[model samples]
Each structure stands twice: as C-alpha cells, then as structure tokens.
Target: MNIIHSAVKRVVKKSLIVALGCAAMLSTTAHASEKVYRLKLAETWGPNFPIFGDATKNMAAMAEKMSNGRLKIRIDSANKHKAPLGIFDMVKSGQYDMGHSGSYYWKGKVPNTLYFTSMPFGMTPAEQYAWFYHGGGMDLMEQVYAPHNLLSFPGGNSDIQMGGWFQKEINTVDDLKGLKMRIPGFAGEILAEVGAKPTNIAPGELYTSLERNTIDALEWVGPSLDLRMGFHKIAPYYYTGWHEPGSELQFLVNKRTFERLPEDLQEILRVAMRTAAYDMYTQATHASGKNWSTIQETYPDIKVKDFPPAVLKALRDANDRLLAQHAEKDEQAKAIQQSQADYLKQVRSWTNISHRAYLNSQAQ
Candidate 1:
C-alpha cells in the first residue's frame, strides 16, 4: 500500500507540471497572435491628384489584404491630419509612420530632392525608371534621405507634364516678367531667375486664386487634372514643352518605424510600392492620351501652344544657372545631379536606338 501511494503521488505531480508547461506555451502563442501593428500614412495631395492618390489608396488596400488583416494602415489626405508640406517632417519625426508627396515639394529642406522629381528636359517615365531601378538611383536617393530620418520608395511618375497655363500669351521670355505663377521646387527657382514670381498653392485653392487674378499663371499636372480643375476655363492659353519633363512622386516612411517592421512585412511594403509605381505610370500615360483626345474633341475654344524656341532657350539657360547655384551650396545636390546625368547618358543611348526609333517610325 505504501509503494502504491508513493507512485500515485509522483503521477499527480508530473501531470500538474505538464499542464502548467502547456498553459505557458499557449499563452505566449496567444499573445503573439493578438499583436497587431497600425501604420498612419499622410499625403499632401487631395483625392483628385489622379494616379498619385489612386496608387496610394491601392497600396493601403493591398497591404491589408496581403497581411490578411494582421496589419492596417490609416491614410490622411491634405489637412486631414497635418498640413501638406508638413508630411515629410512629420514622418521623419515619427509623428507619422508614412507619407506620400512629390519629392520636389521638399526641395526646400534638401535641394537634391528635386532630382528625384523632374528636371528640365529630363528623361521620360521609362528612362527615369530605368535610371532609378537599375542605375544606382535608388542607392543614391537613400543616401539623400538618410539625414532626414526617412526611407523613400518610388511612388509614381507623372510621365511627361504640360508646360503650364497662362492668362496671357507668352510669346517670349519678356512676357514672363513680373508674372505671379504657382510653381514649386527647382522649376520655381528657374522661373524666378527669368523674372516670374513663383508661389506654392495647395490644389484646392488653385482655381479660386487664378480666377481672382491672384496668380497670372499656374502649372498643375497635365491636361487631365488641369481640365478637371477648370484651368482651361480661366487660363485659356496653355503652353507645353520642357517646364516639368517628368515628375515623380515618392512614398516616405519613418526610418525607425520601417526598421521595426518584420522582415516579411518590409518585403511586402517594397513589393507593393513597386507594383504601385508601375501601375501609376501605365495609368497616367493612358489617361493622358485619352485626356488629350478629349480636349481636342470638347474644348475646341481653348488654345494649345508650344513654348517658342526663344522662350525655351531662355528657360533652359535659367534652369542651368539655378542648378549650378544650388550644387555649389549643397554637396548632395551635386552628387545626385552627377548620378542623374550619368544615368541619363547611358539610358539615352539605348533609348535613342529603341524608343526614339519606334516613335520616329510611328510619326512616319
């Protein structure tokens, strides 16, 4: 009897220990399963910025779907949470986890930021993407953002943009003198040197400002957005050629927040952005062609003109001077410019053979 009782006691103790161990393991698993991360994203543009807004929203949707609802993102548009231009700083400070805006908008903080946007007479969407993805542009861009506590990804490209809208015909560079125009980044600086006063206005206020005669000219995106905003109704004269060759938008993430994500999640974000970038370019290009067709069909009263040779020459000269001045003051600007120039030279070689040949054939 004594032996049997001792055996029984040992069995009970072992059972208890086993049960406790199982309970601890289950608790840890449950805690991990319950953990969820929420990312807050902000953007300066409104919902109407065409591919910019559409691609951003699509990214959030894709993230949630890909994570199977494990990760969530909350996006705030301009003035929804923070001011438009405040997005870069907000994300950098970790006040926000993510931001979407044109890199050129932040050129004030980092002059080199303009290189990631569009340069005067710069490469088109295909050429720019080649430079960025395969030509060391991404690595160089990362270096530029490192000091700002941010990580950036290519968001979207605006393809080729229109010159601008003018209240009065700009037959010569002399017409630009004293013209108050809404432009931004290096383009704005170039305009200033040529005697046009550049102003940065939010999208929503653009129409009112132009209608009220507060601005003499404005350059938004292309005809699609400009037509939607009634820019043609107010500023009847539209000019095209080399003002903003191709504008690229960027998705910026807080460096700390980005580092905190799991490796798998990080990869998901990257893949999602890359997909978004491609989709944006495709959609913008298609929409631009359709919109141009519509403008010819519908807005027959509107006059479309190209920048005269003399005006283009003056603008190009001014842009060169502005770039040199900024590069002298900022080392990063010099580095990025050099990288872009080198990348363009290589891409242009192939593009001249392939893309240019194709375009020329079509024209013929």
Candidate 2:
C-alpha cells in the first residue's frame, strides 16, 4: 500500500509541474506579443465636413479601440502635412502612412481611379458599395493601385449629389461653353468637351471664388454641405442630379505600411473602413434630406430645376466618348473599365429586379 501511494504522488507532482510551465510560457508570450505603432494619417478636407472628416476620426478611433490601443493614428488635415491633391502621391511615396480623400482627384495619375469615385450617371451610393464589396470591385481597385505601391479602401460615400449651383441658368448646352466651372475628374473632362473651362479649386476657396465671380458655377457636394458653405447666397439656381452620380471617398495606405501590420490589425482597418462607408452614406442621406427641406423653406428665391433632357443626353454621350478615348490611351483604364462593366452588368441584373421593383412601388 505504501509503494502504490508513492507512485501516485510522483505522477501527481509531474502533472502539476507541466501545467505550471505552460502557464509561465503563455504569460511570457502574452508580454512579448504586445505591439504599438503610431500611424500618420492625412486628410484633404477641413473639420467642417463632418461626415468626411469625422468619419476619418472615427476610423482611427475604431482601429485604436479594436487593437486595444496598440495602434494609434494621428490625422492631419489639408495644408497641415501636404496639399489636398497631393495625398495619393504622398501615401504612395511613403511620405504619409495613410491618406483620406476622393479617388477622383487622382485621375490625372490613374484614370481608372475616377471610376472608384464617380462617373457621369454611374451607380448610386448603395449600388456602388455593393459593387465594391460583393461584385469584386474592391479587388479590381487593389489591382490598379498595386503598381503604385498603395492599397485603397472605401472610407466614406456621399450619396447621389446635386448638380452645380449656377450664377446664370444653364438652359442649353451652348450656355456651358466658355463657362468657367469648378468641377473634377470625368465631369470636368465632359465639361471641357462641351466647351466649359473646368477648374479644380480647394474646398476652402469654393465659396469665395463663387461670391467674387471667379467661377461662374461650382459643384462642391450635396445640399447639406453646400448649404453650410452658403453657396445658395451667391448662386441661387440649384440644379438636380449630380454630374458625379455617386462620389466615394477613399482611404489610401502605403502598401509597405499595410503589410507591416499584424494580421488582426489589418482586419481592424478593413472592417472599420467598411463600417465607416455605411455610416457616411447614411449620414449624408439624412443630412441632405433635412437640408433640402430647409432650403425650400428658407430660401424661396432659390430655384431648383432638373437639367434639360437635351443637356443630359449631350453629357452622357460625351462621357461615353471620353471613356472610349481613355481606354485607347491607357491600358490600365481599359482593364478597370472592362472589369467595372462586367461587374456592373451582374449587379444591374439583380438591381433591376429588386431595386426597380421598390422604386416602381414608390411611384405607385
């Protein structure tokens, strides 16, 4: 009985030691795995653009929170770290760890980037998001940015926007000729094709330029933001339907910076961006609706009208021609355009049945 008791004691002692060793190893690993990275994030807009600016802040906050404070992002607004349009290049060249801005602004460098932002009569915000998330649009965009040593994710989305606020009524295509307008990307190109001189102005200068007659017209954003900027006071003719269709904001990261992140941190960034994308669209839609009502109530003199059918047709035709021209000049543009067309075809098939049915019911 004594010999049996001694053998059992030895086995019990060995088991306890093994368990204690495992605990010690686990504690050591937990201490060793703690990681911290301070990321510099840049934005091309002021704090006044809450949906855009605030969403970026929220993204940073989410990353910190999800990573348990291991990752910190410091955001610098335009002119603080770099110029507004210089964001993509700044991130690509590793001058900035990350950047938040409209993808269309970089069309000169990568024509395909414009599709990720807006196109003449392109998809609405929800549809565009669907394309990006499920329709393989995100993968395609990553491919386009791969060569630039950057990776971009959808940060926010401004739902369908308003057309420009014109100083004088644009009743015909002829009136657009020689009109100096503040616009960007494909819309700017289309404006040029129609003989209007398109100018790219920073957000800060938009109101002053319009008030001082530096620009005959300007398309800044939807009604909410436009109202805040007081564009209606300068140009009272508010047109319907944005030339941009759905303007999507992008968050760009240096490829090397992204690759250096832990797998969990990478996921935190992507999921946070996806969440921000939805939140931004929701906020913009709500704000736009409220602001639209306010505009009608307070600014009785402001005229809201739809673009003439002829003008719309002319613009659409011009867009097609410009897209074709771009495809011929840029191989990357051709690939992106083809990918978008194919994905859009599939999404439209589903949308025609689901989205169309809902819209038709609304009309009823």
Candidate 3:
C-alpha cells in the first residue's frame, strides 16, 4: 500500500512539471510572433508639396530602415485626410497615430501652442533650435501637449520666411489700413491691431484669391516654396520677413501610441524625427537660396522691398502689446514667452557677431 501511494505522488508531480513546461514554450512562441508595429501619420500639406512634404517622407524612411522593418510609418496627406487643420483632434482621439503640421495652427484650440511656432521678431532658426533642444523648450512643449494626450517635436524650419507677396508695396504704416490679406494666427491679430483686415484662406485658393483681387497679399513660406505658388507673378512686390523669421512646423504623436512602443522603437523614432527635421532645414536653406537666385534672374518684374523703419517699429510695438496680453492671460504662455526671449537674447549676441556680421561685410 505504501509503495502504490509513492508511485501515484511521483506521477502527479511529473504531469504537473510537463504542463508548466508546455505553457512556458507557448508564451515564448507568442512573444516571438508579435508582428511589426505600423503607425499612420496625417500631414497638413497636399501630396508632393515641397520641403514640408519631404520631411515626413524622410522620417518614415529613416525609422523603417533603422528598425529593420520592425517599425513602419504610413503617411496620409491633406488630400487623403481631408482635414488639414484637423490634425490636432485626429491625433488626440487616436484616429491617427501621428501628425505633421505647424504648432501655431492649434493656437485656437490650445493657446500655449501659439508660442511654439515662431513669434513676431522672435528667434531665428538656429536660436530657436537651441531653445527647443537645450533650453527647456521641449519640456514646456510637452507640458502644453500632455493634457491632450499628444507629444510635440520640431518637425523642420523654413529658415526666414518672406513677409508676404503684396500686390501693392507697403511704403508706410498707412498702407496697411483696411488692407485685406490672408494672414493667420498671432500675426494676423497684430495685423488687425494695425488696421489691416486679416483673413484666412485655404492654401490651394491663395493664388486664385490674390489674382482675382479676393485678397491683396499672402505669405506662404520662403522662396523655396513661394515660387511654385506663382505669387510673384501676380504680386510684383516681395517683402522681407518680420512675423515668422523661423517658422517651425511640428511633429505630433499620440501619447498612448507612443507609450505602447518598445524602448528601442521609441528611441529610433526620436532620432529619426530629429534627423529628418535637421535635413529638411538644410534642404530649405539650399532651395531658398537657389530659388531666390532664379527669381532675381528670371522674374525681373518681381521687386523686393522691406518694411519702412516707422512701419517696422509699429509692427514691433503692436506685437509686444499682443504678447503681453497673451502672457497676462495664461501663466504657461508667460513662462514660455520669457524662456524664448531669454534664450534668444543669449544666442542672438553670438549670431550678431558671427553670421550677421559676416553677411553684412559680404554685402558691402
């Protein structure tokens, strides 16, 4: 009887061990079979649009290559998404995993977002990049985006954007009175304060509006992008930039989607986005210079002009007051505004001594 009981105990223990081993093996197979993660990105631009469109493509490619097919990104343009301005809501709600658009575009939905793009007479590209990466700009940006279940990063820079293509040259402050222009965001508010009637227009309709006298002036991007719009043909006067000196587009990711990514994948995505952004900036710089040269040589009818001293001063003053109002209303806005101002002051001193001085000397 004792021997039979001992044998029964041994058999039960062996069966239990076998079942546990099978469970472990199944777990290993399940993990190994996990499929590659694919994310969908929505962009604000139309298909094949210039530097802006190229940035997303570059990011997608870099991420896929680095991850060896473990991470794949699919992009949907404005035409496919049919919601150029709706990128914010779509990403936040998880309708899309990512988005590419200007940070300022979300100013209406999220006021603090306005400060992330470019400000009137704000820091240049190099200065802004320093602020974003080195100066707490990234943390502040995260703070602003966190509540919406999103993360934001600098997508690219347009360098110094041209002020606008004006049908009539702006010679005096008076020239802005009742001027109907397709200007948006904080800049549009400043223009309104200065007696210009600011309006918003879809990018595709900008040319037809300007040509048919529906709008008097419009600022797209720099020469890299403006030449294709043919704004110079209709509006003979090209103005130097003031509002968006370093227009920075934003890359947005759904926080939930980001959190689910493996650690290696998360790092790969960050590096890819940063590289693509820097590459786009380089591309923009080259394209702007090359296209500007083309305009000078081929489009003799297009005249370049700068805002008069008095008008510039007025713009600066109006912008200051507007920012003051913004800062007063929101504590986050005040903090971001001050941080950017402080960072710009520190960097501009060096910029003035180096790039500015060198360029000024070259012009002589």
Candidate 4:
C-alpha cells in the first residue's frame, strides 16, 4: 500500500509540472502578441452612403476580427476629407494610409490607372475577377500603381451600370453629336470622340445639374442607387448600360504603410478587401433586383430603350481608335490592352457556351 501511494504521488507531481509549463507558455505568447496596429482610411463616398460606404466598414470590421484585434481601421468619408476626387493623391502622399475610390478617377494623373476599372466594353464581373486573380490582371495593376507609392485592390463592384438618364431618346448616331452628358473616365473620352460633351459632376450636384439644365443628361448607377437619386423624376428616358458593364471600385493603400505591417496582418488586409468586394457585388445585385422591380411598379412611365445599332457601332469604332492611339503612345498601355483583350477572348468563348447558352435555353 505504501509503495502504491508513493507511485500515485509521483504521477501527480509530473502532471502538475506539465500543466504549469503550459500555462507559462500561454502567458508568454499572449504578451508577445499584444502589439496592435491601427490604420486610417479615406473613402470617396459621403458618410453612410449605401453600397459604397458599407464596403469600407465591412473591410475594416473583417480586418479587425480576422487579426484578433491586432489590426484596426478607421474610415473617413468624403465629407470629412473634403476631397472626393483627390483620393489617389491623398493615399500616394501618405496623408491617408488608405483610400477607397474608383481607379479611373485618377486617369488625368496616371493614364494607366484607367485600365483597372471596367473598360467601355469589357468582361463581366466573373470574367474580370478571373482575369485579375488568374490571368495576370493583379500583376499588371501592381505594375501601374507601384511607381506611385500606392497599392490598389478591388474594393467593390456596382455590377452593370446604366448608360444614363436622357431627356430625349437617342435614335441615331447624330443624336449623340453636340449632346452634353455627365460621363467620366474612358467612356467620357469615347463620347467626346463621337462629338458629345462629357463632364464629371459630384454625386450631390447631379440632380440639381440635370434639373436646371446644367447638364442635359447623366448616368448615375443602375436602379440599385439611381432610384434614390430621383433622376427619373426629371428625365423619363433610361438607356441601357454600355460604358461600365462591370464597374469595380478600388482600395488604395500607401506602400510604406503596407510594408510596415507584419506579414500576417498584410494577408489579413488583402483577404478582408477581397471579401468586402464580393459582398458589395452581391449587395448591389440584390439591391438592383429589388429596386428594378420597384421602378416597374412605381414608375411605369419610365422608358427603357437600347442604343440604336448605328450609335453602338459608332461608339465601338471610337473606342477602338482611342485604344489604338493610347497603345501607340505607350508601350505599357499596349501590353495592358493586349493582356485584357487576350484574356477577354479566352474567357468569353466559355461564357458564351455556359452563361449565354443557359440563359437562352431558359428563355426559349
């Protein structure tokens, strides 16, 4: 009995030592991981702007949660920053550690920035995303932004955008001539090529501009956002989208800030941004579906028309010519354009067989 008792005591002593060692290791790890990183972000949208603003909030939340509180992000909207169009400069100069805006908005400052956003007649959301992740799109984007001390990522997608709200129907190519439209980026350039005067206006001023004849027509987003803007009240014609089919917004990070982050935190930010982008796309799709139904029920007088074939052809020709000119002027532009074109052709064939075929079969 004495021997058995002694053996039990020895086993208990060994177990206690093992338990204490584990506790010590856990305490030391907790101390080592206590460091926290905080970042500030500037967004182009006003405070609490629906789909766009939600993206930044979602991304911040995801980063904080995924990093177990090691990373935190604070967001300031355009109203706080007071410069919606200056996101590129703000992030590049490190005035803001990060920014959320459209990549194309910086075309004037960096011509290559134009390609990151949706092209005039580019791939759909799925195709574009595949191109970015698998077809070398992300690498090209990095090449374009790296020189400016900024890192850009896909922030969100607004799905397919509508062409615009017009006071009158555009029946022919001539109708576009001398037309004053509120468009932006490469699409605006294409309009200019076709003799239309295209201008960019702030979101807050769009309604007033169209109502007071400051602009003849303007394209906001699709039904997801447009219904709230009340553009239908002033302009009865809503043309279908052709310009930004898969409009992807961007998140810009300062290079110095990004490099300062630990590798794990850096990966957390990337994953957060990507997940938030997809969330925004799904949200946009849901909102557009709901709002489109609402429009049909509430505003039956709204005329939905497709651009005439002649106008489409003219626009396509203008797009090709502009692209050729850019390609001729810059070798990088040529490479990026070729990359996009090749990827589009490769994926679009499958898309026709899978998506297009399925849709047509269902319709029939």
Best lDDT goes to which candidate? 4
Candidate 3's displacement at residue 229, Å, is 0.9
On a 0 to 100 scale, what is the lDDT of residue 316 in model 2? 86
Candidate 3: where is the Cα deviation over 4 Å? 1-34
Per-prediction TM-score, please? 0.91, 0.91, 0.92, 0.92
For 22-133, candidate 3 gives per-residue lDDT tens digits of 9999999767645589999999899988899999999999999998888999999999999998999999999999999998888879988988888889989999998999
Candidate 2: residue 86 Cα off by (Å): 1.5
What is the C-alpha local distance difference test score of each model? 0.85, 0.86, 0.92, 0.94
Candidate 1: TM-score?
0.91
Model 1 residue 312 lDDT score: 85
Ranking by TM-score: 4, 3, 1, 2
Candidate 1's C-alpha runs over 4 A off are 1-34, 47-49
Backbone clash tally (model 4): 0
- TM-score of model 2 (CA atoms): 0.91
lDDT of 3 at 123: 89
**TM-score for predicted model 4 compared with the true structure:** 0.92
Per-residue lDDT of model 4, residues 1-364, tens digit only: 9999999999999999999999999999887687899899999889999999999999999999999999999999988999988899999999999999999889899999989889999988999999999999999999999999999999899998999999989999888888999998899999999999999887778999999998899998899999999999999999999999899999999999999998999999999999999999999999999999999999999999999989999999999999999999999999999999999999999999999999999999
